[model samples]
Structures are given as structure tokens and as C-alpha cells.
Target: MNVTTILLIFLLGAVLTYVSGNKLASKIALGFSIMAALASFYLLQLYLANQNISFNGVWLQSPKVFLSLQADGISLAMVLLTTCLMPVIVLSSFGNIYNNAKSFYSLVLFMAFAMTGTFLATDGLVYYVFWELALIPIYFIALIWGNGSIESRKKAILKFFIYTLAGSLFMLIAFAYLYTKTGSFLWNDLVKLNLTSTEQTWIFLAFFLAYAIKIPIIPFHTWQAKVYQKAPTVGTMLLSGIMLKMGLYSVIRWQLPLAPLAAKTYMPYVLALSIAGVIYGSIVALKQKDLKKLLAYSSLAHVGLIAAGCYTLTQDGLSGAIAQMIAHGFVIVGLFFAAEVIYRRYDSYKIKDLGGIRSQTPKFSSLFLLLVLASVALPGTYNFVGEFTVLFSLYQINIWYAVFGGTTIILGAYYMLKMFQNVMLGETNTKAFADVNWTETFVFVVIIAFLLLYGLYPKPITDLVTPSVKEILTIINR
Candidate 1:
């Protein structure tokens, strides 16, 4: 099957889930998500066998846009991240019931469809369309189903929507400008233009603005913590786990190759900004009293490092960024699920209200400890492989870069450990904390196993991503 099949599966699953009614929506959504995962793995098999898994067709006559979906190791890795995590995201919600379950579940699958299309689309216009499509579902999901007072949640979600939308328009203008220059928006065509340094700089900043707001790098990240706290856990998972990677992926896929000189010219400043974000996010996370917000800031720190790796413009940096994207996706989901597990029993997310859970729920505490350890990038976890490689690349560029970037690990460990201590440990509380049920245990097991397995042996991921990273680097340096 071609890559289009995977997109169709999600789209179809979304439609079917919505019509299935509340009773079956969750089950149907979970089933379709698993099917999409299987389809993606099969697609990977085809890719490994040297088969073309891409789809190309004409979608419009006037603009001459082709419905192009390209698959390479890099894109497939991202696709796997989206599809695989989808089931986990859906399953993670089984413990909590929502009003309008069908609509909620449907939006979840629809967001997956858009994100998958974003990863696979090769035409600039097609990619932009998919990117914008993703925002719609999350908007409704957060606005209608999110936590907190109605007015506050509305304010947070609205600010996020406007910021992202405005930034995306800049990217659209960039793509439109590039289309005029190249007479095409295909990936191959856009990458071939030899624009003036001035042209490249403008184009680069436009795309950077789009990705930066989405990635929410540094100053652009104001909306993140509040929104992450306000959104439902599943919405947060989709945002943190898979959605954040889109901007990082776009940096490598669209930004650098299209404006290599701009990338080179700005690399130092970009790296500095990214490292600044790492330090800033980590420090901010240290003071967060809410569990989800703390995790949100921590996500900012981790992704800052990943963005730094991307701008390093080296093979190790690019590959490590992708690895960390995948690693962070799973680990963050598990971490958020841990918060949800607590909320399930205690009806709260405040660190002040939580404690003594380690004594009451040994299974949950042990699993959460593993997740926290993974978050801190413990030596034997998947995060370590990604973090180490990214930092090592920074060290090669400048020891100071590594020194500043390394704060993520040190500062990260401090905040994470402290948060864990306050939330999961301490004297037993009067309120009894229940152990994780089968669904929660299954989710934790899957995430931890993947992290440990890949942490110990990252060769498969390394091999898969290396060739693609090399190609992108060559394009950047050409």
C-alpha cells in the first residue's frame, strides 16, 4: 500500500468513529488507530525493501498542485511517531469519561490525519494545508472540553490560536513567494532555487516565524504552559507528543534546505536562542506548581535542545533531533498520563494536594519513577541516546554551546526529581490513592519498554535516519 492508504485509514476512522455513537466511539477509535499503526509498519517494510511508498496525483489544475505524498526514512519515522502514539493517546483516555465522547474521539483521529499528512506531504501547498488543518480539531478540543474556568480557558486557547495562525500565514506567504520564484511548490523544485542572500534571509525568517511559534521557541512560547494546563490530557498528549515535532521536522525538511545560506548565517544566533530557551524553560519549570504546566515547560526545554540540534546543521545533530523527537513524544505522553492517573484518583493536579502515592500505589509509583527517570534522560533510557548525541554535536560546534545546552540534563534532573518527590512520595495522605488499573499499566509498560529497548540499542533508529540526514545535510551545504 502507498502512503495515501495510511491517511485514508485515519480519515475513514474519524468518520466511522463519529458515527459509531458514544458507546462505540472509543473502541472504534482505538481499533482504527491500531490499524493505522499496522498500516504504517507495513509501509515501513515496503520502504526497507526499496519500494516506493509515495503517492502522486494532480489535485488542482489552476495552481498545478500535485497530491504528492513522499516517504523517506525521516518522514516515515515521523509517521510512525504519529500513528503509533495515536492508539496510546486514545487508550490512555479509557479511564476518564468525557461529555460528547464521540466528538472528542473523532477530533483526536482527525488531528492524527492532518499530522500524518503533514509528515508525508512533499508539495509545499499540500504540506501547508495539512499543517493548518491540524489546528482546527485542537481548537475545538481545547475550547469545548478543556479544563479551568470557561473564560480563562477561552482566553488561553484564543491566544494560542491567533499566534499560531498568524505565524502560519507568514509561512504561507513564504511558500507563495517561493512558488512564484520556482514556478512550482514541489520539494525538489523549491530546493533547487538559488535565491539572493537577502531573499533567502526573508524566506528563512518567515518559515522560522511559523515554526518558532508552533515550536514556541523562547519568546514565542508564552501561550504553551497555560494551554497545556487547560487542555484535556489527551489534547496535551497530542500537542506535546506529536504536534511539537512538526515544527522541528519542518526545520530540517523545509527551512534549512530552502535557505541554506540563511541557515549558515544565522546558525550561531539560532543556536544561542535555542540554548537560551533550554535554560529558560528548565528554570521556569522549576517554579511550576501544577503538574501539567511543569511538564509543559519541561517540554519546552527538551524541544529547545532538539531545535538546537537541527540548527547545528550536522549529521549527528539532525539525526539526534529526530531521535529525540520520537523519544520525547512517547516519554511526554507517559508523563502526562501519570498526571492524569493522579487526577483520576485525587481529582487534582496541584503538587500541594498530591503526596504519599508511592506508599499507596506501588505499581503506579514505580512506573512513574521510570517515566520520570526517562524524562531526566537516565543513562539507560531512550532519551539519553538522543540528549547525549545532541549535546555532543553542540560541543563540537562550541564547548559553551554544550555547556549551556547541558543545563537541560542538570536542571531537568533537579526539577523532575523534586516534582516526583512532592507528587509521588512523602507520608501517606488521608485520601487513598488507588493503584493503576490494567489500562494504565499497559500504557506505562509499552512506553517504558520502548524507551529502555531503544535506549540500550539505538542502532536501528540511527541506521534508518542516517541516510536521510546525510541527504538533507548535503542539500544544506551544497
Candidate 2:
């Protein structure tokens, strides 16, 4: 019925998931995820009818802290993305998991709850708490159930935890500064404060450090490959698919609007860094032998383009970034799932060790190919629409920038096709390999269907995001 009611339900689901046994854990998680999705859909409908919703009260008057939850078009869209993807992620994990299934499912549900809170909280302190809170369950999930040797998993998880936490500390400092300026933690209060240029610049830099590490612009990206490589596929899916977006979302929601002059003055360099990340990530991906590592680099490249779009500071760029965020979320999940399918059958993700999978698993091959094409931004897929919008917006900023960003399409095709050819097109291996079962097929097919549906008729999503994008631009231009 309301934000708190829905969040409580997810919290309850998390508790239930933890207590449940392995046999029923997945089913319980899935059921709760489905309910969360339905509740989010209802919330979206209500927001469309009413425009906005908020719940505000003094939680600690002495410190000027408030318990505030608000939903706007932007927050609602992200909420919808979180709710929509959780069920799919839960379903995808069904066959792959066994031991500690209850803990696994509980972590997943807990992640959903944290992500929703991050999206909805309107107070800066509340938002930061949710932001950091979201990371704990994922760190453990990756550390406990990840693919590599125990030491490797531990190393990867530690790197991930440290990198994100280090960035967040700077963000915490920025929020503290803002609290001093406004004497309040409320989002509106902070936004209305007339901050000096020097103050805005410093705050922007602090926020940038946090979000850059999360969006993981090039030099800061060393932790990502190892983490993605070691984490279980479900954990990888949530990290890349949902968690990364939180950084980009914050950049839009907090950085650009709150520090408009700083954003304008520093955007060119930021855009250049993003462009560098695009090229660097693609080049690095071309050399990766491990499938998970390759996808990890590719994810970095894709998000770099989205970050570039955000810095372009145009409506089309912002909207396109949102579109690409959604597109990449689905495409990366499917790509990782495809990798998981091969890994399950062959017990190897090394490109050299796999070949001629298509001969044994035509269905799996077809699905993998489609997802790969989507990753490479083929027409008639969701990624194409997002890429096109982003590139178009970049062109308005600078033709060379657009040209550099466009090279991702070429490099992407080279690496993804190379991967497909190496894995699927050679003579059948003498070693035995199994095709994906009905469950995997169902999961892959659903993702593919949504990809195509959005590709062909992206207007609905564009329409949903447009008003918010315009609102953001209004703030920037004001």
C-alpha cells in the first residue's frame, strides 16, 4: 500500500529466507520476489497517477535528522528495475545452487531490500546508510560461494569491499560538509542551500571519487575483473546488473543537480575519462582468456559509455544513459548466465578449453548468440537503441567523442564474435558436453524476449524516463 509497507514485506522475506531450509529457500525467495515485483508495479502505477509520494517525520530533531522516503519518476524507475530483476535472478539461480541455499536466498532478498531503500530514501544520511548497507550481503555471497579457490574468492571479495568502502568514505565526508552548510540532512534542504563555488567543487570531487569507483572508471577498475571472475554467477549478476547503477543514479540525483556549476566546469575531463575507460576496457577484454573476466571488462566498457552520457549534461544523454543502464543490466545478466551454462557443462571458462558447443547445444548456442549480439548492440535488440541514443547525444557534444565511443561497437563485435566462434563454431570436441536444460532455456528465452520487445518498442520506457530527464535538465539549467 505504501513504501514502508512494501519495504517491510521485503525485510520479512529476508528473515524468512534465512530461516528456511535449502529445499524451500529458493521457492520462498522467488515467491517473495514476485510479491515485491507486484508491489513495485502497483507503486509505479500510483506514482504515474499522482506524480510523487513522500513520507517525512523528525526521527531525531536534535541533529536535524529526518526519516524521509520519497519516490519520483527516477527513483520509481530504478525501483521497478530492482523489483523486476530480483525474480529473474532468483529463478536463474535455482538449478545452480545447493549448499547453503537458505543463506544464499536470504542474501539475495536482503540485497533487494537494501537496493530499494537506497532508491527511495530522501535524506542524505538515510541514503548513505542504505548505500553502504547494500554492500555487506553481496560481499559475503561472493566470498562464500564464489567460483575460484577459497583464497582467490577471499582476495577478490576483500578488494571489492575495500574499493567500495574507500570511495564511500569520501562521500560520507561530502555529506557531513553539506549537513554543516544546511544544518539538515533532508534532500530538499541540502538542494536549496546556496553553496559557494569552492564548496561545491570540493563536494563534487568527493562525490565523484565515490561514484567513479563504483561506476569504476578505468584506473579505478582493477578490483572489478577479479571480483566478477570469482563471484558466483548470481552474485555477479546482482553486482553488475543492479549495484553499479546505484552509482550512476547517485551521480544524477546528487552530484549534477546539487553542484551544477562544478558539473559544467568539470564535465569535459570527466567525459574524457569515461571515453578512455571505454577504449581501455574493450582493449583489455580482447585479451582476456577467462569468460567471466572478459564479461567483466566488457561491463566496464559499457558503463563507461553510460557515464560519458551522463556527463554530457543533455536530456538525450541522460535518458540514453538510463536506457543503456536497463539494457546493459539485462544483457550482462544473460551473458553471465550463458557463461554459467557453459561452465556447468564443461567445467571451464577458459576460451581455449571450449569448442563446438553449438553442435551439441543448438538451443543454448542460439540463445548465447542472441545475447552476444545484444551485447554488441545489434539492431533489433535493446542495447542498440541505448547505444544509438548515447552516441547521438555525444555527437552533439563533440563528433570526435562520439567517434571514439562508437569504436566500442567495433571492438565489442570483435571480442564477442571471437568468443562465440571459439566456443561454438569449431569441430565438435571429443569430450562430452551437455545442452542447457528446460530451466536454463526458459530463463534465457525470457531475457531475450524482453530484449527484443524493448528494442522494437522502446517508446514506453523512453516515455517513462523522459519527464524525469527533463526535470533533471531543468535543475541543471536553472
RMSD of each: 0.6, 1.3
lDDT of 1 by residue, 1-478 (tens): 7999989999999999999999999999999999999999999989999999999999988787989999998999999999989999999999988899999999999999999999999999999999999999999999999999999999999999999999999999999999899788899999999999999999999999999999979889999999899999999999999998999999999999999999999999999989999999999999999999999999999999999999999998998899999999999999999999999998999999989988887888899999999999999999999999999999999999999999999999999999999998886777998778899999999999999999999998888889999999999999
lDDT of model 1 at position 413? 98
Expressed as tens digits, the lDDT of each residue in 65-150 for candidate 2 is 78798887778778888888888889888778568899989988998899889888889888999999999999989988888799
After aligning candidate 2 to the native by TM-score, how far in Å is the CA of 258 from where it should be? 1.1
Residue 334, candidate 2: Cα error in Å is 0.5
TM-score of each: 0.99, 0.98
Judged by whole-model lDDT over C-alpha atoms, candidate 1 comes out at 0.94
TM-score of 2: 0.98
Q: Which candidate's lDDT is highest? A: 1
